[model samples]
Target: MNQIIIFDFDGTLADTLDAVVRITNRLSGEFGYLPTNPETLSQIQNLSSWQIIQQSGISLFKLPFLLKRVISELNQDLQLIHLFPTIPEIIQQLQKKNYTLYIITSNSKINVITILSRYNLVNSFKNVYSGISLFGKHKIINQLLNQENIEPQQVIYIGDETRDINAAKQAKIKSIAVSWGYNSAEILLQHHPDALIAHPSELIAVIEQIKNPIG
Candidate 1:
């Protein structure tokens, strides 16, 4: 089997943070929360995923319904969204190298696939595990290892959040945190990922070094 590369959808692969903010503000009236402004968003970006949610003033009991509505909203907006810079080319390069790509996202599967299709990237990834809970990515990571009969050493989890680093740690897989995602680089660094990459162009070299480190 090809070496696997698992990705997080929202902030990692798809540049949906801005869209999320817009949607969140739009839903604030119906959901009865304050609109998140850029200043608030900047502060939220320093916190972990779960922490951000807690700060949202949405109780855990109602989070599922809120997420349902958010996912539905995102479904309609996915195509309008874009990937991080140079991501499409990088993914194509990875595909050419025969890496088995998989996506684990809190977003709906249809939403993930829809946007990939827009970029002519639907076939670049082998599978997408969608609708993962905010704090439950480790469980899905474990499930992916089991379901795919994959060895942990042959896999790397690449994502943009502190929670992704935590999940990779829990799953005992190497993690690379991209600086351009949901959390600031400083905050993500505090979480201690195996590596921190600053750009899409740096990814291949970093992965190669990780896979075949020089003595």
Candidate 2:
């Protein structure tokens, strides 16, 4: 079966947490947002993006500009970003199996592409859809579905955040929550993703199970 697999870039594919924290702390003074401490980092990992924004003291009115600056700073430190262990192999194998891959992310496309290209994994995804909005990813998913003329059942979105699972549910599509990203496995499970993956290799099995269920 031809499956449309949508992935989230930041926590899902690229390990940007530490780097993001460093950048955020470096810019917190200038942006008027609170600098994240070690404890706050762990706590924020469990919170949704919106919750994190509120806790960080960033005004909603300034979020777009903040996002743009965040992206700009992140791009400068692209050397620190990398795909999680075994991710390149998993993605390559999925591509070899003829799965249609796409990435919908809040991170900038330039940053995503730079990392993918660095690791020679740029060709794995068929499309890279990016946005800065902390909400409304479901709308982006819907737009992708319409653009490709595909139904919800034919696609599965994989991410490491609560928002990702929520967006998938809102779009009425299956979601695979990855444990290796921002949100903890426990938190991700609470969102009731169709599948929860602890490692990259589990992705192959989940896709197979989704495509060919046995009685």
Candidate 3:
């Protein structure tokens, strides 16, 4: 069977920190709360928006209103969103190797599609699963495994958070932690993923190593 690679969209595939921080702090100011400092915000980059709100002690009642406003602003800024440097080349190389790729994200499907389209990467992925239920990645991975008849051993999951590592473990698939994304290297290292990649180009080598283990 062909090997499969699944990616986390926001922090792993796209460099969306600037837009996320800008909108988050803007909403914080509007709600009369002090904005999170860049250093602190950087640490939580892997967290979903709702997770951020919960961790920040924002009242649940106000969260819906604030999130709606922030998302509205983000939608308009999609065109300006930046892709991680070398990501396009990396994807191209992976595609050339006939690797089946997919995206699993907490983001809405519309947003994910839009971003992928903007980068001309819409056709690269075989499918996408997004806006899933809270803590949905493990479930999604299970479904993908069943539907595609893919063995856990033949799959690799790449993501930027501790939760992602946990989810991959729950699904019994190999996991790769990306240091260039949301969580710090220390935080991700605590999860002890199958591999940790600090650069986009490193992914190709990691996948190759996994597929062809040395004696």
**Which of the two candidates, 2 or 3, achieves a greater lDDT against the reference?**
2
Q: State the lDDT at 54 in candidate 2.
A: 75
Q: Tens-digit lDDT track for model 2 on 82-194?
A: 89988999998998999999999988888899899977888888889888877889998998999988899999999999999999999999999998889888888888999
Ranking the candidates on TM-score from highest down gives 1, 2, 3
| Segments of candidate 2 deviating more than 4 angstroms | none
Error of 2 at 104 (Å): 0.8
C-alpha displacement of 60 in model 3, angstroms? 6.5
- Reference-based lDDT, residue 20, model 3: 67
Per-residue accuracy of model 3 over 1-215 as CA lDDT, tens digit each: 79899998877988776786788887875675557787777756646534665678877667656656666677777887767899988988899999999888766667778888877988999988864443568998898889878889989999987778988999999999998877777778877898998999899999898778899
lDDT of 3 at 210: 78
Q: Predicted candidate 3: what Cα RMSD to the true structure? A: 3.0
Worst 10 residues of 1 by lDDT: 126-135
Off by over 4 Å in 1: none
Task: Name the runs in model 3 displaced over 4 angstroms.
Answer: 29-34, 42-55, 59-73, 132-134
lDDT for model 2 comes to 0.88
